[model samples]
Target: MAPTCPSEVQERKILRRSRFGCRNCKLRKLKCDEGKPRCKRCSSFRVLCNFMPNVPDLQPVTDDSSSTFVVQGRAQLQPPLTSAVWTSDASTFYQLDAKCQDFVTRYLGRSLITPDDPNMIKVNRKLLILAFTHPFLMHASLAVALAYDRHLNSSLGCRRTVEECYHRSQSTTLFNRRLGEPIETRDKDTIWGTAAALVILAFSAPDARTPEESWPLKSSDPSDFEWLRMSRGKMSLWSIANPLRQGSLFRAMESTFAEIHSPLPEKGIDGIMRPLATLCHLKDSSTPGNNPYFNAAHAVSQIQDLLDSQVKVGQTELFMRSLHGPFESLLRGKDPVALLLLYLWYRKAGRSIWWIELRARVECPSICSYLRLYHKGYAAVHAFLPGGSLAM
Candidate 1:
């Protein structure tokens, strides 16, 4: 047996510098000099460079402690980790399980606006695509999907409370982490998406509260209205991202708000509420001319006008912004009329999940009880009010 010659030794394969090398160089297994317009080798050969675009950077899937597990019948299947690659520095599309992917896809495909406004559909689609590149948005989208899924399944008598809560917790953890960052430094897209996510979270998740903390025994403890505190936080976030008013997400939100704040038709339920509205106005007039109750009623009327308008495109946000003043005044004054107005406002705002969530969290029934205790004669009339009628 003779010793092998150095020239006969096999060369080990090495990773290429550019995955998108020129065709000639790639075919010949030659290193590409990825030059703009054309590589040196391609130039020398007088051939088309034809370099492919670089693929996006994504961390390859790896087994780790955080890997997802699928539970089925008392046994867990450790499916290969299939989730979008989440990196601290940037977001990259990876993969998701079939069920999760289908949910996202369906949400994107659904019509988000009325038939008359086709452009909004395009805008929501863009936002959904943007969600794939932003972690906060991605988490927020997933949270919405989880919440919607849970609600739909519950209606069908399939309870998934534990699983839904677990996923929601994970999604919110990511959402809050991004939300806590300084608003000024974040990009416009991120800020816009954050606002959208916050709205979704407001409706989907329970109001933020101190874990294990019970309801305050004293009403004046300041922590009693944890849900109100959460609402204010959402308002603050929206304020910070106010510049994104031009965006489609904001427009969609405005549309939803408009639908919620639309005036009750004058024929049916309006008749029941008319007397209460009249009494509220009278009470406001009895006070000093600069009554906060009057201000709130005016604000509510403006909201109604915007909702009833034929062209309500940009009015939703404007009305919402204008409303802050009356809302704060009403809360500060602790006026029964203001409280009743708020209850009615929430009742009217039927389209938004946020208002629905707020209605439940704020305990409208408790507010009604407080109103009755504070004001006697009107309370009797309120008691006999028909279902779905506004009570003063």
Candidate 2:
């Protein structure tokens, strides 16, 4: 075979110069304008600009694990930005695959998970960047992203998809190891971020479709309220991570922390409905630390405040916090008052938190059935619940 220069002297199509742009520009496969200070595309998109002025020559990064140097085909990341597809084999820097890009970009652009706060998104964007550096965090993030995607697209069921399960398992293994080993200050945020992600994964999925099969209604098991336990368990990492400390990426979330750690009122009956107060046996002396029913009753009342104020975010965590200590024991012991308060909380909280509805829809009705069957005397509280006829 003889190599020829050309059969008929053909003209070369001159391609546009790109390649040496900022991370965001390179990520979208756009021909970088190579603008100083900030790139036009990133500015127009309102995304973070990681551009450097008078950049040095591109050298292979010491850590390919978190590098955005890999070329993921635009086909995998949708909305059709380019007519040309990247040559798949040209990208040798592996690990950050097309799916990861698809998920993160879609998540940031769409505001899929935490939609309310721009500040929250900024913190999460930083967390996501950190996720690329930590394998466990990456797994945890993907697990949550997949769970939320399933929640949005798939039909109602508590079961997680296989991808969700695999990520969750992998993250758990590595997360524990990171905690056990002495961690650097930089690693602290990664631990906290992964912990938060894993908690969301746990809360997002439940294993039952019926209240009879759900916790408290179902036969008592050691794993009852395991999701609640896992979420609360993350508080142990608070001092370790010190997320609220200055210079921490999560310091932007101090408002969120305040919302979470709002002190319990001195009197549990402060805002409780008379019926619920009586049901919980709330007295002038009742406090969360003293009376067992006080916390559960207080939690139920707070839901009304949320409704009255038209507040949605952070209420799910508030309800679960009530389930700790005496309230949890009472719930596991199947105390009538605890079950009644829980049913009321579910009825109110279901409307706001998307994932809570999955458990609440089944559990609310089941609580009604359980009450009717076991605690017939409490049927009078039915007036408080919207669908009280079933309990009656």
Candidate 3:
């Protein structure tokens, strides 16, 4: 029966639900519209739209006790011209690193020096300039540049046009060449490695999402492994190596060491042993920049793994060769700086016993002497040491 069409009140309630955007968006305080072509808000926002299901048979009854009542309201929505969007391009990205940029700029300016090293002077000056304009952006940009420069010419070395080396390093071929491979036609591994490396170096310090304070230096969580940094992003070394499969970057870094004239290990597989040993050597040296505990541990563990493995002598020598470099640095017997580095690696790897062994091995005058030298610089350059332990 025509049943008076449930009066004007019931019809208004039906129309309201029939018109426009999905119920989810509307419930969430987002704009929406009930429409045929597209909801007004969805169209304006350039987002997809969906409608609530209609149940034709389910009719409203004239029950005075029912909470389901209808109200007639009229409001028109117009599609807007602009909508929000996201893209991979850094320049177009939002102001995420504004704070970090400011801090980096000021830090560089304070440390700016008239070094005899022209490359250092140049990079320092450029860094200063970027600090004032955009520190966070510069950090990433400079890293890319530095990586690229390394890719172009292995002999070019770091501390020069670091930004350029970093940039070019993103190119898989360029990145692979830094490890002594000729730029190749196509290797996705190289490309991924390049990208991963840039991301690690560029974003390692001073970022909001993964703030250093919250992250464990020696986490066993696989999630924390940053392949580019050759350190775990979250997981512990045990868990990281098995599932994360970070052997590639380690291989690349090891190859890079050998390519740069560092001796290869004598035993184990040529691939992993060389890189692991090289990392150990680098960690032991007075290399510039911060050497985080996790990083040092990762390198150390990788070296220990090779030594413990049953491999050919020459292959094993490649790994053992790394010990000589660091050992020599330790044997000078002037200070405990070598011991300190070893200690950090041992501690981070959760090998306190190993730390004790390393500490005991170092000659006193050298250990004590280096400790004093490190103390003076520790306050200033301690940034290289992770976990911010005031004591060296």
In the range 1-392, model 2's lDDT, one tens digit per residue, is: 01112233234344474767786566344667878776786666544455753221121223322333232224242322334211122211124446656776676333344566688878878887766557677767877788777777866444665446555765786678678878779888888888887777766777665455666455666765767777877878999999987789989777767867877677747787777677777878788777888866776677666652354545546667777787887888887778777877776776666556666667676666666566656666655555555331
What's the lDDT for all of these models? 0.45, 0.64, 0.31
Q: What C-alpha lDDT, on a 0 to 100 scale, does residue 158 get in candidate 2?
A: 49
Residue 218, candidate 1: alpha-carbon lDDT? 11
Deviating ranges (above 4 Å) for candidate 1: 1-95, 111-117, 150-186, 204-278, 281-289, 302-334, 351-362, 369-376, 379-392
Worst 10 residues of 3 by lDDT: 206-215
Compute each candidate's TM-score over C-alphas: 0.52, 0.70, 0.23
Alpha-carbon lDDT of model 2: 0.64
- The TM-score obtained by model 1 is 0.52
TM-score of 2: 0.70
Task: Please name the candidate that would achieve the greatest lDDT relative to the true structure.
Answer: 2
Pairs of colliding residues, candidate 1: 260-349
Per-residue accuracy of model 1 over 40-158 as CA lDDT, tens digit each: 86666544455643311111122432443212223343334444433122322223445556767776444333324565576566667666556556545655666665544443223
Query: How many angstroms is residue 383 displaced in model 3 relative to the true structure, after the best TM-score fit?
Result: 28
